[model samples]
Target: MLIAETSEGKRVNLSQLSREEITGLKKKKHYCPGCKSEIIVKNGTVIMPHFAHKKNSQCFFFSENESEEHLVGKKLIAANCEKYGIDYELEAFLPELQQRPDVLINRKIAVEFQCSPLSIARFKERTINYQAFGYQVLWILGTKLQWKDSCSSMQRQFVYLSKNIGFYVWELDISKKEIRNNYFLVSSIWKKFYQTQLFSLEKESVIDILQFPLKNHEEVSYEIASKVACEKRIHCWNQQLNQKSKSSLQLQEFFYQEGLNLRELPVEIMLPSFQSVLLKEQELIWRFQIYQRIQRDKKMSYQSLYRMLKQNFDKNYPLISDCQLIKYHLSLYLCFLLQNKLIIEKEGYYYPTNKKFTLKKTSQEFLGIPLKYGMINK
Candidate 1:
């Protein structure tokens, strides 16, 4: 709420004014641009100078308790837009959508500086609403919402996919006065990892940095779990099964009904693929399902396999706009099988080789054969 409209309909930006100027302006009346409700100016030494709605005023656009971090971050983005001479409207309210973004760039890009917790339903609704009106919404996380070792379900909803950067999220740091592009993000069973690219608000143009991935044609490479690491992860899953954990017990029961042993899953079950993030089920579970289908059918078409995997995919990821990721991951897994001579494809049908599934004494023996673990080419 940095910008407020005067009685004469002229917009006033408190961020651009000095303390004395703001103090003088407190004498006049101002209103919120969104709800057109009367707002009071707060010139406090603790927090940044901004407009606040009167007590008991129920404004749909302005929150009663907007955090200090959110206000600062919003003003920082507005300053960056000003620095670049980019045409932007601060806290612009769209009547049709009844949503007020922190900053609207060129009347198309809605920059939302989310410093507080938001429900997934509301987040999805806002995102879908913006997209419906041809507005591209960019969600930038504040310090409070940034991910550490691994992302929570809510944090995962902020991740966006791209060819050059793979999966990415944006973060704003007020202290650093910089925006971070955490890209090529991948997750293991235990943790998540990614590389970061920082853009200084003082030196970089926000528009150019945001468009870099869209314009760049080169692909990015990320390391997957090593062979030993993959084996250890499977060994951990076996340990959970031995402990009779509820989830593990459920999976084991399902496998037992299908005449399969959870402890002796094949090496192919744990291979890493970028699209693994799309599913909440373990890679071993879904991969074994694929193997079982191939075994029973003897041969299957790509469409059929895709439909089968779709049943298990975790479709809760709302930010990942691409609907064909399941197809992409399935194709990658099939290619790996083809490369290893474990499966042969001819006339659009995949035929499994006569590779026998055997019992293994140790986890090390599960991945005895050397295999690739990361991204696969189609």
Candidate 2:
């Protein structure tokens, strides 16, 4: 929405011009860069001056309604690039793909500012198009990102396009011009997200982000990440307990009927995985499902039981995750069960040790355990 097509077919960025110039340019006719429909300049005092299509224009960007925040965000990045003397362009148009990036640098890197919720499919399509044109795409999400504050089940989802390619959520405090870079390194093994606090670019002369070494950055151990995830999940449940989310209320009632308390879930059930984050069912539900199944079956035929669970999960939690997280968690859960002597395996089958046993530790107590998975340099 920031870029408009002039009568000469050249892209005009109103943000670069002075208020007097923009106010004067509003008198002339303009057109939407994306739709090529007649456009008008919105020279508002509060929002940055940008072009908007005429009434009822069928432009996709019109429906999106470019936010003031989006306007200011891209300007900030452009300013930073200029300050550092990096060669850049604003909304560089690609004639072949008919795509315009928010900021293009050195005719190679195209930066897309995602201020609005974009479809995963569209996001991929844009990236693919950029790659096909030999341009490296860097996705920077606008600061609209929000995760549920309470439920552990409502864990934050960090979309990593690959080990090297991932989404960047830029927390730009416009007033202070501070950018908090919260980078995530996903565990391909567990499919769990691990966040790394990268160095600030507040004073950098050259942007090394071009190197994109996210895969090499290790910030937290699997143990601590799981603990934090568990805390968030519990917080969500506690919130639901107060607000009465039907599902949480029902889960609590089920636990109560089973002679159990929601808060005091056994330590063995706090399973964590990166890929399994898509699952809407709380970790408690799935973990308890396994526990009850093992208790009832006396001994579990690991292969058959795993296959059955996998089939159900394929339906409940799609194969959307990049890694085999569900499978890893199942195997890891079995390891935990064996380690605690909660279950014993004989001839490739697992059997419960005792009919009934008092809990030695709770999920809360297990938080103290040091994370031990992968090459945990952190």
Candidate 3:
């Protein structure tokens, strides 16, 4: 931890002191703010000067041995806070919540710089606890936790929703000394897509950057899938069904139970949307479910459809405290359906169109038909 309480109960920050000053202060007794246990100062030429708990100390706050990257990231944020003249506390422990954020800004915003893997249960617990106490918690992920081609279920929990940016994640690059605002994140069956805006820690204020989207509204444009791409994916699904892949078998079983052929389903089932990320099942599976429902019932209200598909939606995004994401995605899906003429909306109810829903026999046949809906604009 960066801050430690002195013998006289005064808080001292080792980072603010020079090497000589830190060496002199090491002579006096200091204790941890969380457990009030004696903590020794470790001033090495390589690592940052900080306090460490004694071996076998049972303090939750100082239990884990912090990595060099974690230490550097914390120091960078601390320096940024100072540069912006923001009132903050380093490693401040909240006795009420029994939690210590990496940096507490104005005692309201709890900034956590997570460099290591955290279980979903623990992440949710800390997030809910902070929110319960009326403190907005922001989790800035480290390089280790950043997603590559696709977003993992654990990484999705870090996504925060905002009016300016649909959904976003904050990433700190210790190597570059910059923070990346990866916003408008959308997921596909095989990949995750998003736009990134980098903010140099030397140039931007961390507090101001957090609120940048709110102040400046920017349009996010993304293509869900091209007709050719969708056709290719459908072909891949057909191959999976032929091979009886586990997931494919499950989806096929559902289609069989409904007296429908999975491969013969309408091409519209392959359509993707930004909100489809909320679905726990594959987009095609749930989309087909909705398609089948409308086909059987002739008409359905949005409320009834949402209720039916509630089980299909993922409800585990703990960091997204602002919006009802499931409903938001469903609304978008309905809008997309309406746009594609697959469904007609009238008086808050959706009815299947007279237009026939059929799949082409070959990829060439599918590509011959012009797709009216290719991308979703946000």
Model 2: residues with Cα > 4 Å off, grouped in runs: 18-24, 63-65, 80-170, 183-207, 210-244, 249-267, 270-280, 288-310, 314-335, 341-358, 361-378
lDDT of 3 by residue, 98-152 (tens): 9999999988999999998889898999999999999999899998898566666
Per-candidate Cα lDDT values, in order, are 0.75, 0.59, 0.74
- lDDT of candidate 2 over 327-351, digit per residue (tens): 4446656766665577998998889
Comparison by TM-score, 2 against 3, better one:
3
lDDT by residue (tens digit), candidate 1, 252-325? 78778878777665666655423354454455566777777887899999889888877656666556743555
Clashing residue pairs for model 3 = none
Clashes per prediction? 0, 11, 0
Q: Of the pair 1 and 2, which is ahead by lDDT?
A: 1
lDDT at 341, model 2: 72
True-structure Cα RMSD, model 3: 4.6
| Better model by lDDT: candidate 2 vs candidate 3 | 3
Over 4 Å off in model 1, which ranges? Answer: 215-227, 238-250, 253-257, 273-275, 282-285, 311-314, 356-378
Q: Give the TM-score of candidate 2.
A: 0.59
